[model samples]
Target: MTAPPPEQRPDRPRRCFVIGPIGNSYAAHGSPERAAYEHHLEVFEEVISPACEKFGITALRADGIASPGDINEQICRHVIESDLVVADLSGGNPNVMYELGLRHLWGLPVIHIGEDGQLPFDIASVRTIKYQRTRTSLAGTRRRIESALAAGIQDGFELLTPARVLRAIQPGAGPAPERPPARPPGREGGGDLPGLLDDCASVEDGLDGVTGQLAAISGAIETVGTLAERSGAEALDLLQAGAPAIARLAAVSRLADALRAPAGELHALTRDFSARTAALDSGMRTALGLVEAAGPEERDEGNADFLDQLVSLDEEVRAALSRLAALSASAGRMHLLSRHLREPVRDLSGALRQLRSAVTCMGGWAAAARGLLPAAAG
Candidate 1:
């Protein structure tokens, strides 16, 4: 008799929720603490919120809920309902930590994040992500959070760290074989699954590098906007100098106009990528679910129903892989476009440099002319 193919187990879908102190409660007791609370709100909205949206995870900010009685109870309800909880430990707020503890007790998957300086001693043993609280830090933090959330959703509570969780879900993972260990590029010892994990790690690293470049482009756009504003303010001064200097003034005007056009385009591209990246990250987490359910022992079953489900999941992974490839291609195009714009921007910068030198020379000549006039009058 032919041996039956192994029965595949069903993978469970993941649903995640975010929990933390909000409103006036996030800070310490006094007025001085109020500013800290505001800062937390800002980061939550600008950084964490976008990150959650990208990962297809529901983020519940406690501050938004109006019903007042027993806030902890409400937090507990959310945690119970969620497949995972991500807690922000910045400001060391007791309430958030307490909620986090409650989730931990339930043995649900939880990801902890804190500002670089605000990590609590109690969570020292637990894996936590450290993030900088500044606007400059938002994109990097968002990527890390997405990666962490993906890992957590895939592996459950026991696999808190990304590297550990990644190792577990990687195809062909098994206990290390006894041998004289050859060190692999991204693993402790040479192994097939570890090698695959290294490839995945490299992909994540490339994603991070792209994210950083996008952030730098965003920052540059902001800086250019500020420069354009300053140039506008200086326009009247330039006109007062002489009508003959109109060409230089016009050059500044054109540069500002040119900067605005490409900046807007780049901004749109970045926003689209941010949204797509979040979706891709979420989809990857869902794919990991299939791997989790396809445990070695489960494959012993030859049930047709389980095999059908496995086929469905395989199809889903194929779809996601295609989407990921498209996203990568779109990102590559955007990067190339950004690079293309840099040459024009450089030329504009040169024009501005020449204009500035002319303005300085005119100022020196004007001062000399005034000095000579005074001597002649005397």
Candidate 2:
């Protein structure tokens, strides 16, 4: 009943991209600089990779991606798209800094680590796991990294990056707080088998409803995006020209209004789903224990259906989240359009924030579920 190592497991592994100086590999063998480069590689293998694998995350460095494409594009994709990133700040490498900046701007979770005492003052405020090259230090460093990753994956990563601080100060920005925690429905312990089935059934039902809701919102956002694409100069010119411009502006406002209700609904549903999944964490851990006791065959057979449903829901949520991100960018363009449009745009932006928070919660839930379920983790 013991689970296999993550790489040997049946599920698709979560990815953690490692970003740090690739050190001059071409440096003359045994040079001091060459030693520094080799040490970075050692950190990846000794500290970072093991920590990530503890959570089924495959650790990949920039040079590790094997796909055929522009290396720059590949690195960018991994930086932006990987489930997690571990940034090594040793020596303050420029390329590493640039990639870290991108991940921060994108507002994804990143764990920073550096050589003890070598970190730059400007980034000192950021929490980073520090380590030395000695065998003893690397073991301690790995434990810290594992603990950080586990917490970030379970509770959701919400670091106050520079971009987030700026957004907080923007004219229409407001905090998007999470919904209050509620007891997870359905799944209790072994005492409540029926309740557990009911809990999962309710989640499955919600997921089904959300599929249609997301499709409808996608259509609305498409219309809103097209209207929002109008250049600021064109909008200004139209306003100067009179009635037609007023009508056009009114039309955009109406579209925004149409989007509001469905977006709000989707946000609420995701928040509720996120809450339920989070509440299930302890229950799922308990279930994992049962799986171990019951053995692989029973675990696989028992979880087959439920695991598939979760994987599907994860995909649906991810697609919608990606679309909402684009819609938010389009909505930002409306700041220049008109006064009437601003309020709706502001409301829409707030809705987007709530959605983003909910999605982040869902992400954490999905990661934990991967530990419980053997099926593709999505």
The model with the greatest TM-score is 2
Predict model 1's lDDT versus the native.
0.48
Which pairs of residues clash in candidate 1, taking residues 3 or more apart in a chain or in different chains?
A: 6-299, 7-299, 7-301, 54-278
| Candidate 2 minimal-lDDT segment of 10 residues | 175-184
For 1-378, candidate 2 gives per-residue lDDT tens digits of 121322442233388899997777889998987987799889998889998888888999987888899796688778766767899998776567767765664455689999998897758999889998799999999999988977876665664454354233332243312210111233324343442233245445655655555555556555555555553345566577774865767765665565555445545554554455554443343333233333333343335555555556567667766876776776667646556456556655765665566566556545545655654433
Off by over 4 Å in 1: 1-16, 21-31, 66-70, 154-378
TM-score per candidate:
0.36, 0.42
lDDT of 1 by residue, 237-319 (tens): 66676545555546465644556555455444444444434433422222222222223322222222223332333343334
Every candidate's lDDT: 0.48, 0.62
Best by lDDT: 2
lDDT of model 2 at residue 40?
87
